[model samples]
Target: MIDDSRTRVLARPFPPRRCQALFALVAIAFLAAPAAAAVHPGQAELVREVARDTGKDPAALDALLDRAQKQQSILDAIGRPAEAKPWSAYRPIFLTEQRIDDGIDFYRAHRALLEQVGRRYGVEPAYIVAILGVETSYGRVTGRYKVLDALVTLAFYYPPRAAFFREQLKTLLELPADHLAGPLDTLTGSYAGAQGWGQFMPSSIRDFGVDADGDGRIDLQGSLPDILSSVANYFARHGWQAGGPVAARAQPDAAARPIEAKDARPQWPLEQLEAWGYAPLQPFNPGEPAGLQTLAGANGPEYWFTFGNFYVITRYNRSPLYAMAVHQLAQAIEAGAGPADPAP
Candidate 1:
């Protein structure tokens, strides 16, 4: 049992980053209650909705709630903000020599599966490899929180975003009861509770999971084929255009006018971006839609003219650094620009 006293203690002296402390509060809420109790009104309605859609029984979902609540402490530990620090803080952890080496081996081991998914979905194998490399160090560490706990805590207790988590909760209860990683294994992850190799949310799993190995069930926790397939499926669903450019080094025309800052969609027209002082490394027709995302670099600033495909990568995680890391890692892995290591 976790020291409930520690729950009152912050993980660090620093203020919480990314609202991570909320995860701790969420954990406590689930832990304080019976996981198998009748669902909250919102959850009860959601369960009915899921049951109606999937043709599953609401009664069948009670076990999932219990399982979710059981993993609360583990979720609290992993969901703290330390792991989700900013790029300056996060970069050192992932871009290590060992990680780079393992990335190579991961590419080799899952070469066929990754390549196949890339071909089918138009997402590059290198990008997929990079994603896995960053997410779990090529599956070296998936997590220590039971996905059930993380989901339930966020689903029922985190009211700021209860509706979203509740939907994911509904998806979880309706999935095969046997889909858990193991009875004893508690899968760990970010405060938002994304799970498995790709760090997919339950809704995403339900919507995008695929059986790359031709298996009857989609399993992201244990199967490389399923994980790769699921990642590709997610990219495709987000409008990843095959053989299309993801991003490019661009030079904005000094004379170019800036586009009005609005709630811009990733699918915003590339031509429109070009009109706003951005020019690509190479010449291309202005018919494409792109966005200008600026990030902090080693020196001052780095800018990217991102196409629709690049936007699709952002769908994995909203952060520009996350997307850039995946993109750069893919390029490095494909070029074999770094040392190799054994696959995990």
Candidate 2:
């Protein structure tokens, strides 16, 4: 949701001294307030709804809310997600040689399990590894904020997406009480409440998570099998066509018209796009649905004729830049893994 208003916040330059002073004040304000008195405005309604939905005790839910502290930092982070960056700046962050190397290492380390799940789910191991690398650097940086605090803060205080986060909070509450070994308030995740190696939101975990290792429990944080299988299952459920092209270089004809939607869903057929002056370098099925995307790069604008697989990737993340990064990173990892790596 980084629109013009959020862009202004990101672009605004603040002096170090002023930033330090402002942070200090905010910190002091947060620290001075007791947790018992830190209830969000919509806490009661949230408690009632969650209690009704999950059949949990209202007092218990209320106590969780009372103990949850509001984090302004989460709000600040949400306002400036990585997807907000232009493709020029966004490409380098995920397309580094180091990330690709790490992805290769990750793929090799879990090659057997990944291959097993890939075969079952019809997903490539490199793509799964690339998602892990891009999401949390293969769990090296899976966030540190308490999941409860992040979700509650965003659910009540953040107006733009409050309803969405509220739904996620409900899903988190509705999870089996013993899903996690520890207390709910102790679970840690991204500022937006995405958790574990795959950075899945609560709803996604509930929907797509699987116990791949057959341990009778789904532990995304500690179980590599579950993480890999969950990612593959998510892709398969989202209609990831096996062996389909994700994207291809395209030369836009001079008379090409700009696409109407900025989002990456496949709205145009290949034949229609070709008629509209976007021609792919490789021959493609004319009946297949596709879209033309122009990415701003350091050199210039690069165009691509994206296919349905590309659209499916976008379901995991709405940004076309993110989808492309994952696609390219997967390709790089496959290339780096050499001929020894198993093919999809």
Candidate 3:
């Protein structure tokens, strides 16, 4: 909740660091309260569209949407995602000693179950655990905003991604009531309206979510099997190759052809990359397809050959930095798991 006093600060300009907070305060004052309480006037079409698509009562859906509160903080968070940071800064956020230790502990505790899910889906257990550790700190913190609020605010008010979020909001409404965490008004998730330990958006839930426990429900919040399995399933569906390499640090020769990856997808064969002057430290199959990623490291530029599995991780979140963080964190956790951890 934003403080009323903070809203009064609009009388003066906020410093650069405080600018986001200032925007949040002003927006919240106008967005969350009496005037902005109802669904945005523009959302009348969305309610009708969702009702038509889902075969639900239009009046019911409209009344349900009335409960949503527009959140300005969500807009603020989206505008400045951490992925915008340089790789040097981004790496430290997820690669800290504490997170690594905790990841090891979390993995060891759920080793058997995670391994089972991994083998079933052909996705690595460490990576699955890493997703949880990175997305929500092993479910310690999911976002506080109502899923309804987050999606609706973005769908109706945030113009840049309004169409996309409107679809997410529609997908959410179309899902059977049982699929939700609870009532639409109460369901909570990330600022993007992604739900569960995996932080899946509504469409991801509809598409890749697994009811691994076979209890007739997909409970990503409370069911470890569901969370871990759904994540692994998403990876598998996105083309994670079983037992395939994810990424490897490379030593680029001084004359290494400056290669820039437009995306994480593998676009070069290992042999071709070597011929072009970027040499991976480890020996990989010469014919293996890979992509080169150069990161601005603390020491200098760091080169890495990201393979198909790495690209699969990137599908979960489009940022290559996010995929790299998950990759390195998974590696660190695997190394620290010690004698207790068995091979996947």
Best by lDDT: 3
Looking at model 3, residue 296 earns an lDDT score of: 87
Better of 1 and 3 by TM-score: 3
**Candidate 1 residue-wise lDDT, 44-136, digit = tens:** 666668778888767765444544553456446545644366556555666777777777778877676677788888887777788888888
Segments of candidate 1 deviating more than 4 angstroms? 1-60, 63-67, 70-93, 177-191, 252-275, 337-344
List runs of model 2 lying over 4 Å from the truth.
1-38, 341-344
Model 1 vs. true fold: TM: 0.72
Tell me the number of clashing residue pairs for each predicted model. 14, 0, 0
Model 1 lowest lDDT segment of ten: 258-267
Residue-pair clashes, model 2: 0
The digit string of per-residue lDDT tens for model 3 on 233-301 reads 999999998889999998878898988889999998999999999888988999999999998899988
TM-score of 3: 0.87
- After superposition, the stretches of candidate 3 with alpha carbons farther than 4 Å from their true spots are 1-38, 339-344
Worst 10-residue stretch by lDDT in candidate 3? 33-42
Top candidate, metric TM-score: 3
For each candidate, what TM-score against the reference?
0.72, 0.86, 0.87
